[model samples]
Target: MDDHVSQAVGRPDLVRLDERLICLRFETMKVLSADAAVAHLLSTGAVRRGDTLLDSSSGIYAYALALACHRHGLRCHIVGSTTVDAAVRTQLAVLGAHLEQMPPSADLKLDQNRRVARIRALLAQDPRLHWMRQYHDEVHHLGYRSVARTVAAELGNQALTLVGGVGSGASTGALAGYLRRDAPGTRLVGVQPFGSVTFGSEHVSDPEIIIAGIGSSIPFGNVVHSRYDVVHWTGFAAALSGSVDLLRRHAVFAGLSTGAAYLAARWERRRDPGRTVVVIAADTGHRYVDTVFARHDEALPIESLAPHEVTGTDGPALPWSRTEWAGAPAPPAARVSPEDTVAPVTR
Candidate 1:
């Protein structure tokens, strides 16, 4: 990658189309100390001294929460899937948080439910254990709300179409809330992996997704009367194609969620006879380097990208199977150009 363009892409200045993407990059320009996460938890009553907090998270949030618990003199333990990367596990251990892993293979429903069940069992066994369940935690909901405020503020000067993925529905839901309160007219749209039942609907889907990351089978976010305008669905292949397009065009590397939202945003620009659609690139794709975008022989195969599992329905693949995601079929990839896939034209 050209260092000059790579450094400049984050500026949100060089990019073209849809009123320039704005992000909550306070941590990008400067590192946010653990104090920030700690303060947010303490002030929200989410954490207390001598409390034993147990939580499940993807690596990043787990790392952040562990740090916060450490700072507040709390005993923290985490339950992570065995699929958690080895490196992430090391980091969690280094952070001084006790770790436990989930069982081997099961349908994602079985996998995740088993993990949650384990957490619930552990919580039941120990009265001192405080489950830091983001699903129900208002403060957990607040993390994305704070970021949404930044997105709203940045776009204050122009009309906006908002985009992002739903993991536990917190981020997108919170952003929708903040936008409604602040930018009442801004359109808030969410992107979900096609098979993810997160905000169940048959509209705007791509192919397949399991991803263990964003997008949930269940709806998240309290509806303060229709906070979100629409939830666009994206398939895994489309998301991968989108992620590749972002790298080629905008010089931004982000995860599949980024790819999913990126394509949705471009679709908004293409389909919506409107101006200024803004999508969140969430985080750079550095972590995904080893997974989705890895070398052909080493990375997950394309067949995984396509839907694989069928539930009780009489169909090849589950008819709109919302239970779990089997990756998508990989296409014989070629040059990621604007003609092949849509992306910012700035490059």
Candidate 2:
């Protein structure tokens, strides 16, 4: 009997939304990543029974890690984002995972910084706690190898393009890496929010931006710039409109990130009309009922722009920058060095 929680992950439904576009709904994708990471640690003897697994997350990864800890008999602690909804909080409680949520901030970047500071303090107090660095660790990338294989098996030798939010870079990057080996002609497109620092977009914090589970203000070590053939920077209005369109058009209720990916995939399909375009739907719309669906009428009127050829990694001009990395290397991991002397936070 395969009673493991990891068994409950992956094998997402691939629904054809258009003649050229398909939505790969990975509602429990993070579970596969979390479970795989935890299983690797356990098998490698890096973590033992009663050891507390700690990490910072916006929501999905937190839930995934908590479930993994429950299965492995390990303690779980999460430094959650301020925007984490009640649904996630309730689930964490049910799983017996301790959650320390950061205070409401102006933007995701500030929220993430506070969460990191909190994690560092907790790590200092208890050296036995294992910090699962999901943002920077290579082990997290291993979880998506199966996903790529599934995609390859389904598509065969068809020329495919994969689109999804950049985030920690594990899902999209790992998927791209695996697919390159399976199908060398596959193209990768990464989506990011307007104010995200990941793709070198405007660094200013926008409180209006509500898209979560993707994009980052701090440097993401996991994101391999070269893996992306193009990058899209979608704003709140664009993402909101995309989400509404998905719900209204396809009856596919998914999170804001999925909406953004759908928009990109639709644009790509319209542009080529011959290639098969696949978008990753990271999560469901259950957690985003209030912010996404409730305010659907308020979204800006979307204007589908024509897809342009990308030349280099610096990205396209203005608006939605889409550019090639030209084989640029990923940034260094943001780790605590010996010279780092920041004070620990008590609150």
Candidate 3:
């Protein structure tokens, strides 16, 4: 039995969608990272029980961090992004997490930037508050070690391809990083929503929402560019189709990011039938009920869609575009100097 609900929630279910495809579904994916991060901080004397943990999250991480703080006898204060819905806000409140939500903004970039600025202000005001830099810190990578072991145990020594959103790079990057220790040839495919500066799709904006929790407007320090073998930038419409199809075909009701990953994973599975492809479904579809599932009628057929292959980030961002990142460095526009990296809070 687990000590806390967060431990149970952190565990992922490995569902085989087909012979060469697997769906890694999580109730709240960030719970794994949050638990590990808080534990590490406590062990290193960086934070103590009852110390308020501060961070910015769109939705998932806010809930994950709150659960972690609750499990560890700590307090949580989240500067929520505009995408945070009422369901998440209520849970955060019940979990005793203090949430400061940003005003509505059509641009998610502005929403993210404002949240970071607010976090900085909060940190400056309260020395007791430890800023959990979920977007930038390496500690978030610690939790995926067990997950990698689980995947490795299940799949043996076969060539594998991991498909998931880059997000803060903790989920896909860290899992791949740990998996590569044994299977060095493991292929990592990153999915991104249009307009995320993390992979240089910022020039072209998605007509719909940016698909929160999967992409970023700013550079996340933990995102190691060389980790990905391929990158796919998918717009909201394509993802919606993928989500609807995934539910109809596989009964895997997941979020928009999962839909995008599923779309990318299907293509990867077809291109390389020898390698097993694993898709990361970071969260469930509850929050997306109104925004995504309700618009199922508008979803295009998944079979009719294919990514426009591109050689470089400079190419036009189509509804779906694929590029061979092949261990490339960060694009010039998204690169940051060593000093620009955000350091972990220590007291």
TM-score, per-candidate, Cα-based:
0.71, 0.89, 0.98
Pairs that collide in candidate 3 are none
Local distance difference test, candidate 1: 0.53
Residue 219, candidate 1: alpha-carbon lDDT: 33
> Which residue pairs come into collision in candidate 2?
313-324
Give the top-scoring candidate (TM-score): 3
Q: Residue by residue across 1-347, what tens digits does model 1's lDDT show?
A: 62332123223221343344543322121012233434576666655677667866555556656666655677778787656667668866886888887766534555666666777678668756766655444455554544555555655656677777666545566666666676667776666554444444323333334655665433333222145555555565656766776676666767777776776676555556555777766666766676667632332322243333333111223212222222121111211223212211110
Write the residue-wise lDDT of candidate 2 on 1-347 in tens digits: 56875566544778888886888897767888888889998988888877889999999999999989989899999999998779889999999999999988866778988988898888889877888888877789888888888887877888899999988889988888999996888888888876666766644344477467778877766778878877777766677788888888899988888888877888776767778999999888888788778999976544654334455434443234455554555434322243332222211
Report, for every candidate in turn, its global Cα lDDT versus the true structure.
0.53, 0.78, 0.92
Q: What would the per-residue lDDT of candidate 3 be over residues 1-347, giving only the tens digit for each residue?
A: 98899999999999999999999999989999999999999999999997999999999999999999999999999999988899999999999999999999998889988998898888778767888989788999999999999999998998999999999999999999999999999999999998888888999888877888888888788899999999999999999999999999999999999999999999999999999999999999998899899999999998999999998686847699999999999987677666446664567
TM-score sort, best first: 3, 2, 1
> Which candidate number maximizes lDDT?
3
C-alpha lDDT of residue 66 in model 3:
98
Candidate 1 weakest lDDT stretch, 10 residues: 326-335
Q: Whose lDDT is higher: candidate 1's or candidate 3's?
A: 3
- The true-versus-predicted C-alpha distance at residue 77 of model 3, in Å, is 0.5
